[model samples]
Target: MTITSSPWVHPEPSQSQLHLDVVPENVLHALAAGESASFVPRFVSPYLAGPECLSLWRMRSGQIVDTPTDAPWITRLMVDPRVTAPVGVAGFHGAPDDTGMVEVGYRVDPLLRRRGYARRSLETLLAVAQGHPDVRTVRASISPENTASRALVSSYGFVETGEQWDEEDGLEIIFEVSAG
Candidate 1:
């Protein structure tokens, strides 16, 4: 799938050369409506608005409705400029809470897995958290079966704190790291 080239938004560059462009609400609404073309032409993968990403667009749309300020924190498209296509998605669940903690989530296209996209996404989130005055902690709840995710977080000094049963994700092992 191809997407016409367009300028990337966020100026914060990453080691992976992946730009985590915040997915705008208009685009989210269009993708939720099953029309990827409803969005401005961006250098992104067709998968961003495909059926595979429907639930994400839908969920984030609803989230923006209730917490408009969380828009920027909630979702981003992980795009590789060299390829001018999205490799995956990433960002926090929402703004930092009262405890100064923000939960992170990301996913790489199955075909693009193990290419360091996920790592770059997590690193970006960590860097954001570290730099934001309101953020003091970064959290990730990964499934125990997802050893790769666990290892990734561990390499970054995240500590296993506990586990929880998620309605949609089943059991997940919780990990956290100081954003400082």
Candidate 2:
């Protein structure tokens, strides 16, 4: 139950319900092929299986630059380490940008929601963000209509900074919390 030591990747500490494993594109490939690995996803996550996740995988696969193995930061699978059953996907939109801002996103499986899994998973991710020296702020964009999401982040000290209209997500209330 040891976590990886990569700076950009974090495996959740034992206290968390699900292990937050930083999933690289290559690992995603293995999962997609039904191949085995220590972190291979055991449960099918609609968010992970959707086109958005596939597009992220494809994008990461193409950006084979000098970025650290964990720099992509596009996806992670939350799994029960004992049984290796994936509960959801959570990750940053990308690594911290020039402004030292990184967007966080998470989706817990419908069957697993309301059980505190999302909170634990997000807490783990937030720690990772705060640990990174480059991260000044961790951002979350929740649709005004999504009360659950707003509550989840607000509990973590995130405050509404503003709003934005996204083509796919429509109007979203942008929130942020200092990474420190």
Candidate 3:
């Protein structure tokens, strides 16, 4: 896969040489076995087991792909090479309804926080969503206390709609980025 430079609405420079590739199943198995340790904390949960992570990467050609089980969206996002990396992952309740309105989710490594990776990744994800005729909107659920997360998504045009109790996390503030 080849990474091409594209117009980025965010402040960061568009990465011209970065390509987003689908993670191979073997790599995912290795990660489940705890062979690789990069970006481990950035995963959700099932990924910890190594089967469901379905992780991808932003790399130049000839780079080996590592699988991280915690990031399932990597599978869907890989539907388009234009999606460089997955900033987040969401499951059943957080997934899109029948209307194709999916949720935007992410988890940055604690040490990697505040480095603009999330923003850049999110910008790419939003761009991919906008390009898809099926996606009408992208939603995100964040804890009110997660100031950094709130700021990140809000800066990208996600607006607060309300709050609700999530089975995984208690009360979360709902935000959405509409295609309109």
TM-score: which candidate is best? Answer: 1
Could you tell me how far off, in angstroms, the CA of residue 42 lies in candidate 2 after the best superposition?
A: 3.1
lDDT of each: 0.79, 0.70, 0.50
- Give each model a TM-score: 0.86, 0.75, 0.58
Model 1 earns a TM-score of 0.86
- Which is the leading candidate under lDDT? 1
Candidates sorted by lDDT, best first? 1, 2, 3
Off by over 4 Å in 1: 1-14, 37-46
| Model 3 C-alpha lDDT per residue in residues 41-63, reported as the tens digit of each score | 32322333243332322210112
Worst 10 residues of 2 by lDDT: 1-10
Residue-wise lDDT of candidate 2 within 1-180, one digit each (tens)? 222433222345556556566665566665454443355345445555655456555544454344554444756677765544677777777777899898998877677789777788778778878777888999999999999999999999999999999876799999999998
Q: Give the CA lDDT, 0 to 100, for residue 11 in model 3.
A: 26
Model 2 local distance difference test score? 0.70
